[model samples]
Target: MVSPKTRRVLVIMPAWNEGATVGTTVTEVMNLNEGYDVLVVDDGSKDATAKVAAAAGATVLRLPFNMGVGGAMRTGFKYADRKGYDAVIQVDADGQHDPRDIATVLGGLETADIAIGARFADKGDYKVSGPRQWAMVFLAAVISRLARTKLTDVTSGFRAGNKRAIAQYLDHYPAEYLGDTIDSLVVAIKSGCRVTQIPVAMRPRQGGTPSHNPAKSAIYLLRSVFALLFAVTRSRSKIAVQEGTL
Candidate 1:
């Protein structure tokens, strides 16, 4: 087991027109005591997101066009894999994720292949609407049963991935909205990665509109269920093939 200090970690922030918050987010992550480098993937924003992130002392990767969070995350994973980073941490550029929890997430990587910063794991002031909360609970239960592990927050994006997960995601990542959270976890679990969650506090976005509205949330939930089912079928097929039954 490599020590945390010896491990090369990259903090990847997928930003799209987050000019108002990316700079401060980058600065805060850079100020952490863990000594992790920061990389901001500007997903073809029309604003000054790229320039602002670069000015904030973070390496910025600008996409040719908007690719959503999942695509940006794939780019970051490829960068990390090519650069041989020992671990990668995903943080939101809208200032929802706390930089102080970076170390806590990384700490989970010492024993598990992935560490998720779960907002509802220990309870705080984080609150969602009644309908959204019900949807979250339903999805969490579904994911937990499928993964055969207890998961409190299935949709949380604040997560740390070790070398194996980084390498896996470089080639196999979901390319849909909210895929970075739900679909990515299913991929990681089916690929035999050990995953655990740690309690973390979340802050409201500092700027820009949220990616999900009420209508989008409904679409997200529906698509996510289908995606989860597809993941399960794929996993079963792989198992059958290994057992010489497929």
Candidate 2:
């Protein structure tokens, strides 16, 4: 394990039309004493998200068009892998994720390959609607069973990945919306990366509309279910092949 002083950390923020919040978010993360380098992947926003992030002293990677959150994260992972970063932490550009908790997430890397900052892990004021809460619990159960470990937040985007997980994602990152959450977890666990969650409080978005509305939430649930099933089936097939039973 590398010491904190020696480990090169990259904090990647995927921004899409978050000009109002991206600057503040970048500045906050860069203010940490952990010496984390900041990179903002501008996901082809029509607004001045890229300009604001760059002006905040973060290295901005501007995509030509909106590639969604997953695509932006994939680009970040590739950059981390190529630049030889020891670990990578992803923070939301909408100001929902607290920059102060970045250290807590990184601390999990001491024993796990991935550290997820979960809002529901402990009692907090973070509240979700009835349907969404139920959906999150159900998905968490499914993921926990698949990974053979108890997990509370399967959909959290506030996460950190070690070198192994970063390298795996460089090639296997899912390209769909919310792919950075559930789908990426499947990829990490299948690749033998250990995962754990740390309790963290979340704040409401500072600005910009949320990507998930009622219709999109339904679509997300359906797609997540199919993706989880596919991941499970694929894992089982690989196991059977390894056991010479395919």
Candidate 3:
């Protein structure tokens, strides 16, 4: 077991024009006193996200252009892998994910390669409805079967990864929309990484707004379903070759 004292944990937040909440989120994570080093990948933000994150005690890595969360998170995984961090916990820059539950998420690393902070575990008031909710349930069911474990929230970005998972993500994490969530986990699971989850109560974004339009949500779900299918059929050898890891 990797003890907390011996573990070097890196909290990575991928920010794209999230200047308002990034600073607050960074500060909150730093104040956790968990000795976690915070790294905010500024994914081509046109605002003061980089400046704010750095000022709030996070190591800021600037991307040349907006690469979305997938690109930003891959950069984070690469950085953590190269720097020898024992685990990488992904947090949102918008502050929906609570930093207090971070330790609980990390605790899953004791027995699993990847630990996710799940929202639908009845631990929190977070809820979903309609087609988006159905899609989430279906996706979780499929992914849970693949991982041979019950996962309530496969789409949750609030998650942690140990060394093996980090290496896998560095090689195959994609930049496509929602690819970071569904596709990345599939790759890690197919590559022999154990996955687990802990229930966490998601909070409202500290700043900015979330899109709750039904039409957009349905479209997003459709794309996610396709991403899942593609990820499932992708063989390890084919994935390696596609990512130039072969």
> For each candidate, what is the lDDT?
0.84, 0.84, 0.89
The ten-residue window of minimal lDDT in model 2 covers 237-246
Q: Model 1: residues >4 Å from true position, as ranges?
A: 235-246
TM-scores of all models? Answer: 0.92, 0.92, 0.94
RMSD of each: 3.3, 3.6, 2.9
lDDT of 1 by residue, 15-80 (tens): 999999999999998777567889999999999999999999999999999999899999999999
Greater lDDT among 1 and 3 belongs to 3
State how far residue 68 of model 1 sits from its true place (Å): 0.7
TM-score of 3: 0.94
Q: Candidate 1, 58: how far from true, in Å?
A: 0.2
lDDT per residue for candidate 2 within 50-84, as digits (tens), equals 99998999999999998888999999998998899
Clash totals for all candidate models: 0, 0, 0
Better of 2 and 3 by lDDT: 3
- The candidate that wins on TM-score is 3
